[model samples]
Target: MFGFGIYDALIIAGFLGLQFFLSARNSAYWGAIIPVLFISWLTWLLVSGEIKSILAYLLILSIGFIVLLLEWSEGRKALRNRREKELAKMRSYDMN
Candidate 1:
């Protein structure tokens, strides 16, 4: 089904868990839980082999992609900010 196997499910769960961990401070807890649940539900829908099931899976996947993209952008920005702070601290130490 869509080339997804048990490994894919595990990977999806792991990725969602990691995203949740990274963004827990920035997002509502349910926001992360919802995606992880949707991922599982989508997997089941894909395996059901019905037209409506397929559509449902597609919608879930689309939402998941959007969330992941948002998380990625936020992570990049946070990392950049952290690096800038570290650099500024180092410069101040050097000046002294």
Candidate 2:
């Protein structure tokens, strides 16, 4: 499937899992850094001829982008919820 072997499949799966975990944890720093690192590694692999198929590279890149978008949206939702909660708390204090 797209020139990916079993090991490559496993590595991609693991990377996706890591991305999900980081997103759930709302880790702004590592969430951004990890994808950059992965892209760099992917580039190296392509240049070194380890990954020969363009489709595989594009597939992996697309997956990474999708995960990043999910992470960004989730983070924004969490931040909005946090702010709403803080405002509610302040309003309650004012009422008391």
Candidate 3:
């Protein structure tokens, strides 16, 4: 078992708390912060000897990669939607 230091635990807790609060506010951008928080904390653990095994490193990397992928996918979708709306407006203007 790995024991988390007070500061480490506090940072994690803060991230989780902010995530929850932002989620309740219906802000999707806040969800992207999760990956940043996770990566930083995981890296800290890796360097601090809290996460020692190769398997653990691989597992954390895989999970972080997935989360990052999801975040980017969502962002791309939103960007595409905004572009479509802009194109639609431009087309409408050309017809008039």
Q: Which candidate number maximizes TM-score?
A: 2
Q: Write the per-residue lDDT of candidate 1 for residues 29-89, one digit (tens) a residue.
A: 5346545766776776677754256566777689877977577556556666777899999
lDDT of each: 0.67, 0.73, 0.68
Cα deviation of 65, candidate 3, in Å: 1.1
Model 1: residues with Cα > 4 Å off, grouped in runs: 1-17, 20-41, 48-52
**All candidates: CA RMSD in angstroms?**
9.2, 4.0, 7.3
Clashing residue pairs found in predicted model 3: none
Model 2: per-residue Cα lDDT at residue 69: 65
- Candidate with top lDDT is 2
Model 3 segments more than 4 A misplaced = 1-40
Provide backbone clash counts, one per model.
0, 0, 0
Model 2: lDDT equals 0.73
TM-score of 3: 0.55
lDDT, candidate 2, 4-25, per-residue tens: 6999889867766666556545
Off by over 4 Å in 2: 1-31
